[model samples]
Target: MQSQHIVNAYDQELRKLHSYIAEMGGQAEQQLREAMQAIVTRDSDLAGKVVREDGLLDELERKVEAQTIRLLALRQPVACDLREVITALKAASNLERIGDFAANVAKRSLALQQMPEIGLTRSLGPLGQTAGEMLNAVVQAYLDDDVDGALRVRDRDEDLDRAYTALFRELLTYMMETPQRITACTHLLFAAKNLERIGDHATNIAEAVCFRIRGSLPEEERQKGDETSFAVVSPGILGDGPTR
Candidate 1:
């Protein structure tokens, strides 16, 4: 029957879309890991490689978008089928952003190498590790279609946020204590922020996975722990009494 053949073709196309997403997710995670390693080791070559490799994720995202558009137009998918297409689109978008952020970290690492290494640079390793772990977990959750695993990833984002906030404060204090370190610290700050953003995009992917499987987003608002905006570091606290 023609109807049965068409349905089978549509299912195959959906599987292809999922394949694209999985590939993108894997590439993005590797990018983040390499970018962090590049920073820790102060290897400009590795950082440059990460920047150049970002194009692959960009191309993959384009492929996902094209595939989803074709499926939407030809199949007129609805219900669960519609969710599959939309979730793939969303996951691809998030993965692309994660790639962009990883590339940003790599770029910052290049800049950081030109300056004197600061003590705070060491702190980024742990932060980046947490983000990389989160990304890896969420991508796995998406591939497994495990709504519970995805939810766990979502809940874990707060830990990354809190870690970032703590690092931000430490960088601020370090900058105030030694003005000469400002330039290097600023680069590290941006690099840390990029890693933090990677965590956020990973969380976005987890939420998308939840929606795809459960048909609705989590009911309660996810808690946020990033408190950088309210953080203040008084220069007076660093040295002698308060300055007039």
Candidate 2:
């Protein structure tokens, strides 16, 4: 009977962790959508909603932190349960950062609305879509402990990088060709840059998930110029990637 009680308690704790991660993931996803929409439509009201919800992200972070402490204190989880807790700790942090990125996008959007438009303004919207979609894959990967799926998430990071680079170059061209648009273009530049960093954070979470599963860091996913001299990285660390 005592053993059964322990099992039930453990299950409940695990469910709580799952619920928190999911809640944060849902919020981040919504932020990305709304932030992009706010910028695209210049809807300050939508921007306001995104700004207001930043607190929710902070709240979720605290909830996850408290839960991790409880798990460490009372449950003393071993093996898979332990791994889940640790992954939850890291994944929640990533989700929180993603939320901030969304808010940053909204803030930039607010500034952008005050300026005249330029051609390159449309670029970050699709990039946000790509990043948000990858995030969905990441949340699922964490839920199911799917390392393969996580690797796929890493793969998409390359596409996001390419998109950002293209957008950056195009915006640079605009600034060079028509110096009058430089002010709006610079703001747009910052927005695109933030979105690009958000994609990096998503990839970072995916890498951490890979690490938690396979017990090693996957450095190969770090791109070519990435000077991290670690073998366990790449798909090998996650047990899947370019080589495998």
- RMSD for all candidates, in order, please: 3.2, 8.9
Cα displacement (angstroms), candidate 1, residue 200, comes to 1.0
**What shift in Å separates residue 121 of candidate 2 from its native position after superposition?**
1.1
**Model 1: per-residue Cα lDDT over 142-244, one tens digit each:** 8899988888888888998999998887788778777887888888888888988888898988988889999998888999989887876776554543221
State the lDDT of candidate 2 residue by residue for 194-242, as single tens digits.
7777778778778878888987767673563222222122212332222
The lDDT of each candidate is 0.86, 0.79
Candidate 1 global TM-score: 0.93
User: Which lDDT value does model 2 have at 46?
Assistant: 94
TM, every model: 0.93, 0.87
Residue 48 in model 2: lDDT:
89
After the best TM-score superposition of candidate 2, give how far the Cα of residue 9 lies from its true spot, in angstroms.
Answer: 0.3
- Report clash pairs, candidate 2: 217-232, 217-233, 218-233, 218-234, 219-233, 219-234, 220-234, 235-240
Error of 1 at 125 (Å): 1.2
What count of clashes does model 1 give? 0
Model 2 residue-pair collision total: 8
Where in model 1 is the C-alpha error above 4 Å? 236-244
